[model samples]
Target: MKFDPNSNLVYSTDTGRISPSQVEKVIPEGDGIIRIHKESKGRKGKGVSVIKGLALDEKNLKTLAQKLKKQCGCGGTVKDFNIEIQTDNRELLKSLLEKLNYTVKLAGG
Candidate 1:
């Protein structure tokens, strides 16, 4: 495929021009849920609930938390493998995370 320098469309060598298709693909095996955690005093200090079963060093949780804070107009931070928002807005968090391709659940902490 090749595109003109100033244009946003592209062309294929064999197909000539390609038309954009609005196809939606369904993804499986994405049923993992995010758990909302409560703050606790651990050996280090105050710890909070965050999404579980994710990579130990990944920053997706932090990014999700930050985005939610902005959307909810609340203050929050990401730490200890989780994102802690200032408000206990579970429903809002769920919807927001789902939009970001996460399955969410309350951990009951």
Candidate 2:
């Protein structure tokens, strides 16, 4: 078989698809403060504590979310780099975050 330098390899029987090079994940930069707020806007009056401004990546965020949920004894999730806990205990969240050396502030009403 003659090797062509200008030829591009699209696929091969050994490999199902030729994927592009992996791109680095870009984490959003945050200020030196984390905000904990209560949001019940679209949740039909069931408020959830939203924690934002953490400078951690997705995996770390999820880990932190799990820890927070365990500590709060409630369910939560990490969405868009923000932690949403199914509880209105923003004070508990603030204290927990502060214990971890994060500057947390209660935002919103």
Candidate 3:
């Protein structure tokens, strides 16, 4: 039999095997600060720009993500209180956030 690596995931021994969790939501404090960074790991050397530390709730955050994605002309999403644009768009994102009145900071060198 072919061993399936993903066939054995358990939430708990008593609870038996379970699927992954997707409803995990992060609520960010509205501190009016934002951070942008570039990440390439686990993406086949393709760098993605991540914008985090935004002070917005889920609804507004999603709206903002859509706007940024549209402006960047790329796909993106809001996850774990962070906004991830599919490509390295740090400079553009920073300008956008600044225009939105967010105190933007570039993260990492």
lDDT of each: 0.61, 0.89, 0.82
For TM-score, candidate 1 versus 3, the one ahead is: 3
Residue 74, model 3: Cα distance from true site in angstroms: 0.5
- Local error of candidate 2 at residue 74 (angstroms): 0.4
Tell me, by lDDT, which candidate is best: 2
Candidate 2's C-alpha lDDT?
Answer: 0.89
**For residues 1-109, could you state the per-residue lDDT of candidate 3 as single tens digits?**
7968977555667666566673355675755668788988898998889888877788888999999999999998888778889977688889988898889989874
Candidate 2 per-residue C-alpha lDDT over 1-109 given as tens digits, one digit per residue, 9 for 90 to 100? 8987985556668776564553355777888899998999999899999998999999899999999999999999989888999999899999999999999888997
Candidate 1: 10-residue stretch with minimal lDDT = 22-31
- Checking candidate 3 for backbone clashes, the offending pairs are none
| Model 1 whole-model lDDT (C-alpha atoms) | 0.61
Model 3's C-alpha root-mean-square deviation from the true structure amounts to: 4.1
List candidate 3 segments past 4 Å from native.
1-26
Candidate order by decreasing lDDT: 2, 3, 1
